[model samples]
Target chain A: MNTTLTERILGGDVRSAGRLMRWVDDDLPEARHELAALYPHTGRAYLVGVTGNPGSGKSTLVNALVAHLRASGKTVGVVAVDPTSPFSGGAILGDRVRMQQHSLDRGVFIRSVATRGNLGGISRSTPAMVQVLDAMGFDVVIIETVGVGQDEVDIVRLADTNIVVTVPGLGDDVQAEKAGLMEIADIFVINKSDQTGADRLLRELRTMLHLRPRDAATEWTPPVLKTIAVRDEGIDTLLTNIEAHTSWLSAHGARHQRDRTRAQQFVRLIVTEALSHRLNHALASSDWQSTLDALLARTQNPHDAADALLNAILEPR
Target chain B: MSQEPKPRTYRVLIGKPGLDGHDRGAKVIARALRDAGFEVIYSGLHQTPEMLVRIALQEDVDCIGLSILSGAHNTLMPEIVRLLEAEGAGDIFVFGGGIIPENDIGPLKEAGVRAIFTPGTPTTEVIEYLREACANRYQ
Candidate 1:
């Protein structure tokens, strides 16, 4: 009668899924084994990523989106990320507060994660937690990143549909005219459209889209939509657009390519993290102290010392 | 780069249960805990015991810090503890802070609340207690 955590997760135990997510966050070595077991059961849940600047209503929009998805009889899982303090490594993951309506819903599972010094607006363990939720049979998994600026495009690699949320009067229209978060969006949401300057922001976004070079016959131009997430306005339209994007991806076979790209990135990240762990261990060894001493004494050049250290770890005696 | 594995970052849930709309105490505590380097999940006002327990389980938090100012602490705090225990998550530490009377603290603790920080208790005490309690819980 004894079942492993992986087995329980596969059997749809939500508690086991939460425990596995905690393990992944803490970087427990056993988490890797569980994830390996759960990998094959993934790829079934559609991943949706919502990102925007702070105070842009990203969480509120996600709350509205989840409510809409649930009304249509779909199970949902959310990974909400908030930034950790660089000084203290702490975070206030208040995203769930906006989503308390689904707190007791069996079909909805929401987990909050801290960036924990990882850049790119999400925690290092976010993808693994997504995998856990996917394996637990949630029909859709939504990732809400920390209030991101420009360079946090990592969500594009993981999410099947990336919705970049923007609010009017934040000067985002001007800031987004550049090529970072603006370029990565599969759909653009001008949230809080009830506010002033909404029309101007929409016009600017449309103009920017118009200027971008694309084959109208072949390319999927990301739609610019408007929403007042707090009042649940325009959410149904947003969901329809999301479903449309999904259909587009499938119709064009782009979903398969995206999956391949995600797999490649995931494998590379695992290898990089493993090697970095080993390198950290190696750097604390006596060999590194002597290498540092030689460098300090000017007896060895910086490049040669780097090569020696790499060789020492790569080809250990 | 440290030789030892990274210390597990403790996730604490600050919840307000029952009809009490006042969450200043909870927000203060949540911010204090965040500044002290703990990931704090804030459960907004008027959460039921069922909702709090469900959030705690889903969040996999190390502790649930309940802030109930309504005279309903007697009814609410123990209910949260009972709900958490019923879900087989009694290991998740339960603590409370609010306008609870002195007489109710013992009964609440007896009902499985680990600690109760009445009004006027410094935030540092709670922070220090959590750090020690969470660190010792695993060992």
Candidate 2:
């Protein structure tokens, strides 16, 4: 059954793809069977991350970029991740509202994901979701994230090219120089460029780049581009730079390096989750409950209890 | 009922179809559903029945709410349910809202619309209905 569904998804059945993604979001045990089937067919699509602070026009920019990509005959998949409501665990993925122009396009597929209380705003399922789109034959996959604190940096792990968007007159220049945003930005976009402080924001971004140290051997000159995404201005230039960056990745073999780093992080993430799950299972025993009681009673030190738990877990059962 | 409750992430797609451009109601319902703990995707104005169904399939929404005010509910609303059935997605719950007349409600429900929300219905009603309708869907 899973293989048939996987085949259908690979054959461009959007329904099958959607069902699989829902399974992933719900963390169903059966999702792994289909994901394993889809794994080998992934890795062909270009992954781009669009991130910026709230109200920075990331959605509009991504919508324009999707239009541009479609005009050039590319099939695009978009994952717009929004913060989850802590109370209800629900999310209003308004990014899909901004990009609704492409909603009916057969060549485009857009999925909105909730952060689901995941720290850093980007969901842990995003990379796997992108792989699903890639396996489904999207030429490009764009992950647009709510760029709250740490989100801009977290997206770097998933994207082949990361574009950090900001608006003018928002005091974003000082915010950009705060280290995290400036470091992960492969392309800096001053969206709403027709606004008052466009030029100043552009200059500030340039100055920050100049002040930052670079590796002379493989220095990527991250271009600062301006765009009024509502009017579709500067979209062509943005696409051109994206193409150049992809080409640069291939030319310098940095794509492989990036993939290797992504693989390492992926493995580490899975290992950490697995270890936590196993530890929790081990700690559920009556012996561990006694240990906890001892710690609470101040009969055993925390370090000694921790060593005992580790020894218990490591011992052959 | 005494067991611990698992986290719920029910996805609902709210669509506005046909030429009637009033999306305020749709947006309001979408937000309400979001606040009620359902992931809501609002398909903006002027979506076709085909487009709505496609969005539902691609989005894997558990339910679809179509809002139309062009008095085309007789034609458009049933067409969405038909498409869902034809696409082997009949299990996907279909509902409607708009300036739908009282006379048309029975036919819409017969055509597989589980419920309809007219202009003055409270948002909580829809949320409450969906919670029960979609509860038993998952094993």
Candidate 3:
């Protein structure tokens, strides 16, 4: 795709938007250039990450949330990360089967990504992809992780407001609480609230929240909103809670703090890229296979070997 | 232990486009392709069509597959083909699979999408198709 098409995508061209994401996914050489061109327009969108365990009804919740945002005339972009099979590296039919209902809405764009051992249970390139959406002027970007527990928690690091979802029938909410998902959530959604045991789960969640230690200095308490998302019941309340959290973050300057955290992540990406570049250029010239063999054989520590590689990068031929 | 020789590497790029964040099939297909001895570069979910085409050009892959369960395939797939023309990836074979309606399959293929693998497509079909398509494309 040319710069014109990339620009057209930022100008709200649907076709261009689709193409831009592909470039990022494929890690095309043009990925950086295309994203950089669109970077100036980003930082305007509100990024929200919705995550929870599988069967927590997060997709339905997200659907309701998208409808809420679109009704308010916001352009919404959704990134759903599906779990990859351990052996096949292929996606299971989860998110794709979940939200094919909104195919006609022009304001909503949903892209499903497969997570193939992206260590940390999140897509390694997710943050950059979010920046692409933000840059494209999506008023709201909701990133939904593959609701597979802790691995899905990486959404919190990439999102501005991470919403942790839970449901009634899933045993104890404490498992979620103990996982510290409760700690990262700006808004906790109890979906499928119309179910019989909904109230019990809510009570358990509240009880855990009570017992959990708070960040002594901060007065902001994350709200727990119950919803029957499929019916769209209480979604407005969830939206209201989200708005409240966003307003609170802005008012308390916590949004900036989150931005600084995101900035560090970008820094980490750059450092990783530079290190890889240096290493591959230098060590790739060495017997990379033998070197790896030596390391695996416990003859050399990775750090020392890395130092040796870095030295090679600096050393003249 | 007698190690099996690595199969001849065939690289494919699979992408999801435009606001459809459902990627289960894409991941599965990518993984299956990898295990079948093809080197795969997967763009983690939610890429646009323009992004996919550009990546196909850059990675110099043998094939490009897309999973679009969002039903925007009509609007998005054509755009991918158009961009592929610009990037000179017109020769790169493109295929898609997902919640595609049976009727839309005809149009998708007419737009030059080589194949449309819907839900329930056996992974073996994909591996076999790629082996054939890549051989022919290269030849």
Scoring only chain A, what TM-score does candidate 3 earn? Answer: 0.87
In Å, residue A274's CA in model 2 sits off its true spot by: 1.9
Expressed as tens digits, the lDDT of each residue in A1-317 for candidate 2 is 45587999999998889888887777777778888999899889999999887888999999999999999999999999998888878887767778877867989999888899887658877777888999999999999987684435778888899998888877766666774788888899989999998998898899889888988568788999999999999999999999999999998999998888877877787677666766887889999999889989999899999888777776665
Clashing pairs in 1: none
Query: Highest lDDT: which candidate?
Result: 1
lDDT measured at residue B3 in model 2 versus the true structure, 0 to 100: 25
TM-score of 2: 0.93
Give the clash count for each candidate. 0, 0, 35
Task: Indicate which candidate wins on TM-score.
Answer: 1
Runs of candidate 1 with Cα error greater than 4 angstroms are B1-7
- Candidate 3 stretches with Cα past 4 Å from truth are A1-3, A92-94, A215-217, A276-306, A313-317, B1-126, B130-139
Tens digit per residue, CA lDDT, model 2, B10-127: 8889888899988888888888998899998887888888888888988888889888888998999889999999999887888888898899999889988889889889888888
lDDT of each: 0.90, 0.85, 0.74
Distance from true location, Cα of A222 in model 1, Å: 0.5
Q: What is the alpha-carbon lDDT of model 2 when measured against the actual structure?
A: 0.85
Tens digit of per-residue lDDT, candidate 1, span A1-317 = 39998999898777778788988999988788999999999999999999988899999999999999999999999999999988888888899889989998999999999999899988999999999999999999999999976787889999999999988887755688763877888999999898999999999998888888988766789999999999999999999999999999999999999999999989998888877877888899998899899889999889998887777667744
The window of 10 residues in a row where model 1 chain A has the poorest summed lDDT is A170-179
What is the CAPRI rating of model 3's predicted complex? incorrect
